[model samples]
Target: PAARVVLVERSPEMAGFAHATLAHPGNAHLGDRASVLTADVMLTGKARGEAGLADNSFDFVIMNPPFNAAEDRATPDQLRKQAHVMEDGLFESWIRSAAAVAKPRGGLAVIARPEQLGALLDAIDGRFGDTEMLAVHPRPEAAAIRIVVRATLGARGKLSIRPPLMLHAETGNGPAERTEMINNGLASLFGD
Candidate 1:
């Protein structure tokens, strides 16, 4: 009922599992609308390009790439450098790939640890126009653990830094009402 969707996985076994899981009646409607590809992203640059995944072809690019940094030089045909180096240069390749395939005015959403925010920003290289950041804190007084950032390609604008979202209650027992409210807000934002 909608446009096509593509799923890329590095493992064949995982790809098969995803295909099987999506083949159920509950998801039968997605037939022919989705495809699963088993390919190592770091070594599939040519394949990706051949598949018409050229620059500015997508409306959005979302990824949660591996965070290990010690395998950068182990592969001779890696398409991304940051895929292996968490802090060395892996993110840059991912961002560059996203930017290359994202439409000129498309958007990007990435969820990553708070510590990676600086590296993410550096990789964006001003290609992102407007950006909004949401920090997630464990408790009212605890520091942020993660962050969600939404950015647009080629659309320079001001950054909107919203207040931190607390994930736990003030009493530190569990999630409080405020935590629920924050969760609801995020759900609404994502049209859930």
Candidate 2:
């Protein structure tokens, strides 16, 4: 069954496309069990506030936010601050919002690039407890390119690193395993 999810995207085109492609198919079995909301991460007041979402309502919050350092460099300017820099602290705001709306012991999962790991950890530290890390390697021989992290609210625990997930084929078979995982929702294999 699909859990209640609130997906935020800055681009309407990407959001709508995601709703049509991913949400529709991924939640087909859990009809009316999912809700997809499209809005800019920084400007969405409802999402930032509890009025738009019930307290302790969700089971999980999943996202793959933008990860361009040049675009969101740590700077002091306002526009860049909100857009790229965390001046407006949109990522932290969203994380807090997720923690607020998520049920006790609910999980928050994010897939971010390797470079963003430090910022991500800094942003999430202390706010959400029981953090765990899973590195994502593009190929067996290559360094990890991305990371998958899961954290829960209000509980303290040691961080556990999982085995790296190899996404690309050694012989360059066009990411065979990763492709299947994306196309067929292979995450279900983990049984949550």
Q: Give the TM-score of candidate 1.
A: 0.72
How much lDDT does each candidate structure score? 0.71, 0.66
Model 2 C-alpha lDDT per residue in residues 8-97, reported as the tens digit of each score: 665556567767865566658655655556655443345445334666777777766655565547666554444443333546766766
Q: After superposition, how far is residue 15 of candidate 1 from its true place, in Å?
A: 2.1
Candidate 2 residue pairs in backbone clash = 72-84
**CA deviation > 4 Å runs, candidate 1:** 1-4, 42-47, 68-87, 171-186, 189-192
lDDT of 1 at 93: 72
lDDT of 1 at 149: 76
